[model samples]
Target: MDMWLHTANGQVNLRVSRQLYTVQSEYQTIEIFESPEYGRLLVLDGDVIFSRSDEFIYNEMVVHVPMAVHPHVKKVLIIGGGDGGVARELTAYADIEEIHIVEPDQVFVEACKTYFPETAQSFDDPRVQLIHRDGLRYLRGRQGEYDLIISDSTDPFGHTAGLFTKEFYGSCYRALREDGILVYQHGSPFFDEDETAFRSMHRKVYHSFPISRVYQAHIPTCPSGYWMFGFASKQYHPVTDCNPQRWQARNIKTWYYTTNLHRGAFMLPKYVEDLLKEAEAK
Candidate 1:
């Protein structure tokens, strides 16, 4: 069967060349497929996690948006993203001291190391500590432990259903040091099925954080062409407190995320803004 993602109206399918790896991981079905359009694709529980070609767009925005605004980020906690692509982007900054990636399925992580070695190679870095455990559990008892936290998790269902609740975002808030930021892709605003859940998810995150904002990116492999990321912080305002010049000075090379685009990312469309307003009101 050709790899496909279901949309609100219909579905999108990619031309798959062959299967690279397929396994039944403890937590989910792990599969890697070679596609003519997107190159190597990672699928967990039949969901498109990331594709090599467009991963830079997703990884860069989710990492650098907070990295640019928050002046100094020394340690980071990444929930999911066992593929190591997320950590790979963070390692570009010399100031990042510790990068922790927690994945529930050890088998999926191993598959990334073998098939996506270039991205997964971040695990070999001295700074990254790959934790084989549930991220929600990992965040428990972690108070003021990290400068930043990135939830690179899959959509809320099956294996990750627990992550979308109010308690989990509160856990994320407590896990971060003062001035820390949390960024995670919250799904698309365009899809009919996702719009309600996205608003609710935004509401839950807003409840946990004093400053909660949503941003957009075009991720082709995702369920919809449009995707949103939540930017929640304890102190820093993603736009007002943002220090773009200081971040630009670091000269971290990136494909999609730039210091200039950081502000624009937070500039939501009118419809999206209305949704956020409605979410906040409810």
Candidate 2:
């Protein structure tokens, strides 16, 4: 059977070679299957969160770019990354003291443990504490505790809608230390509807944080092949403040992210620059 996912231009059809598992969690439906091209595909609430083939592209960029900027990331908070990919990346560092993943759906986490063990094994790390609570509510009153906060939620829709709002970002901003960094998926800029939301979300974050930057990664399974992520900080600037030498000393090996590419990711296309410029102008 062919599984279809909506994209900016049209729809991407993944040729499903085998159906592995389907489970309904408290919040959403989780599906695991194999696609001839994508290998294992994780579908949540009718969207492809990631496919084994290209997950590294998304996970590496989201985790390493920020980690490279903040030299001493002792503690990190990942919101809605129940798939465990983000935590898996953070666990690579020996200096990182704590990694907290706040995911509301227990069943989804369990399913991931069984199917995507590559990422799920990260939950077993002693430094990582998986909290079975809503990410937004969990951040409340935890002022200035974490050095990095990763909003790894799904798209800006359904239960994930709150993750992109001003109130949610305010909670994240307050929860981070003065030098903390905030990074999250900032949808595609190719389509009309998604573009509007992307601009609005960046503006909402810009209102709260001083240094707001956007970066891009191309994941074929995502709505638009061109996907962007937000990187905001209270003190550190992503480019000028990036500590490539210090980060390299840690010896955290990654397949996709590099200090050279880290600088290039922020060098947006003129069209993308125009998009963020429009957001800032409004």
Candidate 3:
């Protein structure tokens, strides 16, 4: 049977090789599908979370961009990356002493471990500490603990709405060290709903961090094929301070992320630039 996945842009048709797994987590519905085009596909509450074919694009961009600029990152906090892709990327860096993942859904974690084992390989890594709790609450008592914080959350809606708030961004700000960096998924600007969300999120993030910027990634399975991520830092600038040679020296092999592409990703289209400008003015 052909399965239709509904996103903000429209619906995507997937030819399922098999229904690998399905679970109703405490938070939302989680399903994994195998498609010829996308390979193993994960859908959360009807939205395409990640697919094997282009998963590297979203995962690499979110992790490496900030890590590249801030090479001294040691302690890391990942908010809402239940699929384990972000944790996998973080574990690759030996300098990273500890990685803490705060995810609300245990079902999502188990499902990913069961079906996407390759992507979930990092779950077994000794450096990762998986916590089943609310990300916002987890940051309450934390002060100057982590060098980098990545909010790999679902879209800003329902239970996830609080993740994008000024208060949450403020918490993230407080949770980071003096030279800490934060990167989060901001959704696609091509869709009206996503753009509106981006505006509100961008504004809150702008007010929270001293240096904030929006970067783009092209994920074909996502709503508009044009996704956005926010980078907010306390001291290190993502671009000006970005040392491509320093990162390349690590010899970390990446399929999607490159130093040149990192610079180009921040070059937003005029409309996106104007949207960010409007958010800043408001």
Candidate 4:
């Protein structure tokens, strides 16, 4: 008899089989097959936070927002996205001349390509350059190089804790061009209990860029069923006049992202907003 491990939340059910097969997401039908040493592959409705198969949602938000806001985004850098999702999205724009992806874990990239072909296909594009190295080390070596820097990292845990540090943010500030934009996955505000750490992180980012804001989206696999993204820019504000022509041209249908939804997503709940304000005050 085959054994199965299952977890359910409402109508969603995630199942892992002893056959070493696992579904990565429900909406996209992403699956991975391997041993437990590679981490558990979870199938979510739209996208999984850290898994390779769920790269679409994450890569889209990380790349598109900064790319769209900037009139000319020629050089891009992605940190911690070994799955190549952000690299894939950055290549979508004709203006993006080059994209450099720095991911520390070569094993994750290899595993993704082997088990999650759909998500790994992004790496096949010629415009992307992959580097197997620590993001902090990579950023430290460059100064004012990239037009946009996107950090698609895991939660602030273990090897990734340094990615959330003020020192890292400062390095990012130095690594970006004069008018560059920096976007990072800041985890879910709903499940974030370390108010001090959150506040400090925001403050550190604010010190580096004149414009900084946090946006939200409901990602089922993440904690509290919501995820937050931080956006900061040296010279440009994030708000933009909706370009119907561009929107129509892309023809990208999304379950969560929309023209009107862009502005609406920035509006946090009253309580959440109040907490942010309080944090800023300290």
Which candidate has the top score in lDDT? 3
Q: What is the TM-score of candidate 1?
A: 0.95
lDDT of 1 by residue, 230-270 (tens): 99999998889888789889999987887667878888889
Clashing pairs in 3: none
Worst 10 residues of 4 by lDDT: 26-35
User: For model 4, which pairs clash?
Assistant: 24-43, 25-43, 25-44, 26-44
Report the Cα lDDT for residue 146, model 4.
Answer: 89
RMSD of 3: 1.4
| Residue pairs with backbone atoms closer than 3 Å in model 2 (clashes) | none
Give the poorly placed runs of model 3, Cα more than 4 Å off: 8-17
- Report the lDDT tens digits of candidate 4 across residue range 228-273: 7889888877666335356546666554456666676678887667
Model 4, residue 243: distance off in Å is 4.7
Looking at model 1, residue 220 earns an lDDT score of: 90
lDDT of 3: 0.89
| Best of the two (1, 3) by TM-score | 3
CA shift of 174, model 3, Å: 0.3
What TM-score against the true fold does each predicted structure earn? 0.95, 0.96, 0.96, 0.81
